[model samples]
Target: MDQHSDAYFISRVVLFNDQKAFEQLVKRYQKDVRSLLLRLTAGDHHKTDDLAQETFIRAYTYLRSFKAKARFSTWLLRIAYNIFLDSVKKEKRRKNTKLYPHQKSINPESGMDAQLDYTELMKILRPPERAAIHLAYISGMSHGDISKIMACPVGTVKSHISRGKNRIRTYLKLEL
Candidate 1:
């Protein structure tokens, strides 16, 4: 049934190579994966979609290797993170460019509302830090889950979240 559990679908896919079950799994988690990628790409819809598709492809190809030690969503996010990193490396190579220093340049004519959008805050955080905040807060993922997802130690994930939160707080001038 459609209400079957993730493990149920996973078993179906793993035991029988049931494409329909795998498709069901994809349908269930596609939005979560896409939204994460969208944030990572800074609202670049095309890049988010491409990376999400690649994540799914990698998941499908490597389904048999899934250990089930962590939640499937966490594993999926790990794949997505790796794919995004790979994409970033490829892009940098293609452009033969280095990361420029973050410059504080506000457009004089931009509306105040544009300035207030959280995406503006997100721009200040680097990829790993942003992913940490998004995963810990937006995705409701635990630090341990994020550690697995980002392939980092738990302490590193905590540091990223703390540093990211501090930066956002400073940007918004919030005392929490």
Candidate 2:
């Protein structure tokens, strides 16, 4: 592989504690990581930015654990996915405990990005379904790879995609 390839950059970071190498990796994949997080947060730009930052932090912290068997992007996205899950759990706990009475739910109009039907559609799917569908279709990952990133069985990933598609079809029909 070329010197500028992901494998090279990853090796530099892992072997030499090269912050510059990691920075290069971050610059290379920041857009993909942010895009995934933005969708997961339902167009909530603030939350997405926070989650994306956390993803990179965790990735650098655990850089040695990466086996290089999977693509670097996949590993980074897995970190992003786990961070998203943790945030969702934290938010659920906050709501369940009534920690903030004034805190409002995600406001569709408050998102900084364009409010497209795609964004609205993403809001409808459950987190796993949204992640599965996004990784499978948008990220163009195989179900096998998605299973690895999601830490779920391949069957479960398939089921999520199936259900997500059905939900979208049903939703579109109703909206029309």
Candidate 3:
């Protein structure tokens, strides 16, 4: 039921083995999860989809362990973030490549007038900075919520957003 609370759905899952309740949770947050992943993956839809699938799988496996200290969505995002970090670590071991495995080079012929879009702008940020900026600005989450998700202090989240924004501003100015 659309009107059902997350707690109700979660309770059903924990007590009655309700798969549908879990599906409801997944459906409610999949777009949000996928969008965040798409940003992190630099718009690699295939990789984003795979990671998103892994995220839900892990979430379902670990649903019983959820303590409800934070919002369910926040918990799910934390799982996604951890999975992304794990994948990044694995990729580094596999190829010893840069962050974006299939990073595209700027076409010299595209000329000086090319302006960086959001994805291009995000590419300039380090992972922690990118995650902080996205959670704060795009997800409309509080600094405290982001700190919980990132498993860091609120001050650190604020610092990440501040530094990330400064980097983006500098990059945009240079691009122009």
TM-score for each candidate, following the candidate numbering = 0.87, 0.82, 0.87
User: After superposition, which runs of candidate 2 have C-alpha atoms over 4 Å from their true positions?
Assistant: 1-3, 97-116, 174-176
TM-score of 2: 0.82
lDDT of each: 0.82, 0.80, 0.82
For model 1, how does the per-residue alpha-carbon lDDT over 1-176 read when each residue is reduced to its tens digit? 67899899988988998999999989999998998888788767898999999999899889889999989999999999999988887877888765422223344444433458766656767778878988888889888889999999999999988887777666666664
Cα distance off (Å), candidate 1, residue 171: 2.5
- The per-prediction CA RMSD against the true structure, in angstroms, equals 3.1, 5.5, 3.1
Whole-model lDDT for model 3 versus the true structure?
0.82
Runs of candidate 1 with Cα error greater than 4 angstroms are: 99-114
Question: Sorted by lDDT, highest first, which candidate order results?
Answer: 3, 1, 2
lDDT of 2 by residue, 12-62 (tens): 888999999999998989998998888777678998899999999999999
lDDT of 3 by residue, 1-176 (tens): 95799999989988998999989988999998998888778777999999999999999888899999889999999999889888988998899887655334444443236665767656667777878888888899999999988899999999988877777656554441
